[model samples]
Target chain A: MTATDTHRTIEAIFRIERARLIARLVRMVRDVGLAEELAQDAFLTALSEWPRTGVPANPGAWLTATAKRRAIDLLRRDRMLARKHAEIGRDLSEEDDAGIAAIEAAMDDDVGDELLGLIFTACHPILSPDARVALTLRLIGGLTTDEIARAYLTSEATIAQRIVRAKKTLGKAGLSFEVPRGRERQERLSSVLEAVYLIFNEGYAATSGANLTRPALCAEAQRLGRILAGLAPDEPEVFGLLSLMEIQASRLAARIGPDGMPIPLTEQNRARWDRLLIRRGLSALERAEALGGADGPYALQAALAACHARANRVEATDWRRIAGLYDALRRVMPSPVVDLNRAVAHCMAFGPDAGLALLEELERNDDLRNYALLPAARGDFLLRAGCSAEAKLQFERAAALSRNEQERAFLLGRAKACSV
Target chain B: MRVMVFVKATEDSEAGVMPTTELFEAMGRFNEELIKAGVLLSGDGLKPSSQGKRVAFDGPSRTVIDGPFAETRELVAGYWVWEVKDIAEAVEWVKRCPNPMFGPSEIEIRPFYEMADFGDVVTPEIAEQFDRLREKTPAR
Candidate 1:
């Protein structure tokens, strides 16, 4: 291969190995920022050396070996004491300083657990949610600060500051590099899953970005979710989150019209939906359910999406089942969004009046006062109830409240049609 | 995107030789790594062409051909369907796989198509829809 080809190949190898390398590095160096820098140093070494070394047969292992060696050298230089090796790993201190740190010989097969530890660390609750998101993408997703900045539509310097602060926070915290057991595991895993899901939603339906959807972000989140599922295969919520993302991402192709208008689920071309993703999602849901997590918040949501996925057409959707799932979901998640979705499901399963009754109850509260969806959904139920004038007023209110240009236009069009 | 990863047939694989227990364990570890990376969608080994059949097609005719076809190196001993960011990612992952054959073997990666790939043939109107899902969550 040409030098350029070799460089690209090395880059690909680094992307795959970076996480595992840093995960292992943090366990030894005991600092997230220092470990990441050491990992980058190893990557630079590969770029300069791999083209001449012709890329090893097992490049991933070679990179890991190199990163560990570099990390040990850095520690030796900083500590100026070989005895500190007990904390770094004593087996390595016994070896000739010149020899590599295959040092943690016992950890050769335990990289998986180390990686899970890294995930938990990056998403630790101590950091702000934004900091956690930034750190996770940096340390685990193998993305540069600039890339994360562009992905989230923030300035590169801001992202850099967030990551630097996050690493310092983690450094001060001196968190253990092991997956917590029992209740702690459950809580930490949720943080990891939440961070991942947040990434997906930002991509799927970005709340702040100029573009409506950032497909790259969704793809990244999905990949993260899938990887998390593999790491913690026994965690039903991991699979549950995976299933939810896959099923939702499958609709991405059919979610928008050619004219840049958002396509609601009922009007999307069913044939356009990605069957492969749907199949992957359904199987993931099955895995989650098989693990007895059918009632988990994410699993319940996945079950709700599955009801629509199984239908070939809008009329064929299992509305009653969806309504029931929403009921169950509301019980666990109990948020304004879930309640609004539950209202829609009730409308779909029963009649317009039933939906209006729920909407009336919701309107009496201040929680959803500025939520455009409340007015939009109420307009739909009113229109179906033959209250066109009232529905038109609601639609106009919804259109005014919406920040999305396309959605605002769509809502206004609905309002205009109400006069007919 | 999705790609088909073909583990080319080798002399031992063509002879219906089974992999040793050590090889099996190594391969299992490699597969587990792929799963953990979320690159593997599906994968399987074929029962050698000796147990398979092929049909050749002509203008309107078809002829059945028996197994153990020639060009052994051209035949696939196993394959994996992987979901990856690009062919580059696929190549890196493939490099990590254990030798599928008892002896030296080659592997190939080829990405397949989605409906969007045939843009001209499909609807030209459906363009850039990937960037148009309205924000569902309020800004944090």
Candidate 2:
């Protein structure tokens, strides 16, 4: 392959394996920050060396081995050689075919668990929400701080500081790098699932970018969810999270028009949806339900997704079921967003008037003051209720508050249609 | 054993932005669970790093770093100290925490040393001073 091809190939590999690579390193060094640095160092080495030596057959393994070597070198430079060498010295010294085999064996054994530990550590509650998201995207999603900043519509300097502070906090607290267990496991699991969901959501919605969606982010989040499901198969919430992401991701192909404009779910082409992902999502939802997770927030959300999935057309969707699920979700974890969504379902199932009543209740909510969706939902209800004049005003207001260009355009279109 | 559960800082967190009421309620519920489980000794959130200072020692001189430190991987956002039977027991409790960042974040757990571990080297006077200092400080 040409040098450019090699570079692209390496970047692809790193993107795919970045989380696993960092996870393994964090396990070996017991430091998320250090592990990420070493992983980057290995990537840099690959960028320079692969052009000359050509890409290796097993690039992930090659990266792991190279990173391990770099870590050993770092330990030596830090003058902490004796301490680590004592633990694994004899294995490193064999040098011949036997040593190589032993080293490979050790690497293979250590890498998987370490990656899981890294995920758990990154999602730990000790870190601030911003720090957790920033660190996870960087280490697990394999995104650069600049890329993350762009994805989140934040400044690079801000993101950089968030990550640095996150690591420092972990180190200062002397947090261990390990998969939590027992009761603590249950607590941290939600955080882990949320982190993965946030990654997927950013990709699905592209918080702040010219593009409506970043397929790469979506893919990475789905992959992480799958890994989490595998690691915690018995956790209903894990399957629920996986189900939610997969089902949402299945609609990616239909979420955008040919002109790159946003396409609302009701207007999306069901035929274009990924059947395979829907199947996977249904299977995960089934697992979640079987594990007594029907009431969990994620499971409830997945069930809502399933309602859409089960429909042959927008009109056929079981809006009543979705509304019921939202009611259950509200009972468990109430929020204005959920209430807004519930209003949408109520509108579809009952009538626009019913939905408008709910929206009116939410109107007085201080939390919805800056939330664009409240007015947007209210406008939709008003339009459906034949109150075009009020609907037009609400749509105009929603258009003003919306950050997404496509969303703004769509809302403006609705406003114009209302005027007619 | 004295243990520290570290809460890492983030941009939103450093801004002194409090979690939404919904989040606070959820976290409060979770904290209640921790207390009921007998794993929580004391815990609280921290002010932004901009409000804090870090002092590093080089020989006899101390270099102080201001909040919103340049390196993110080195700041302390908040922490909790608990008395647990052992590290394994502590790990068991940490697993149950809700997602720290409903939007984006991480939490870290570290072990703290006890007076018994210091042995006879720490005099009663020094230990008393340490105890007094710890008592005056609030858990983060």
**TM-score winner among the candidates?**
1
How big an interface RMSD has model 1? 10.1
Which CAPRI category fits model 1?
acceptable
Candidate 1's residue-wise lDDT over A264-382, tens digit each? 78888766777778888999999999999999999998998888888876888899999899889988898888888889989989989888888888888786788899999999999
> For model 2, how does the per-residue alpha-carbon lDDT over B1-140 read when each residue is reduced to its tens digit?
45788877676676677778887788787675444223454566777778888899989999998767765535566777654445544554554566665455666778865445798899867866755564333211
Interface C-alpha RMSD per candidate, 1 decimal: 10.1, 25.4
Model 1: CA > 4 A from native: A81-109, A206-213, A369-371, A387-390, A396-408, B10-18, B48-56, B60-72, B119-140
> Whole-model Cα lDDT per candidate?
0.84, 0.76
TM-score of each: 0.87, 0.60
For lDDT, the strongest prediction is: 1
lDDT of 1: 0.84
Residue B68 local lDDT, model 1? 91
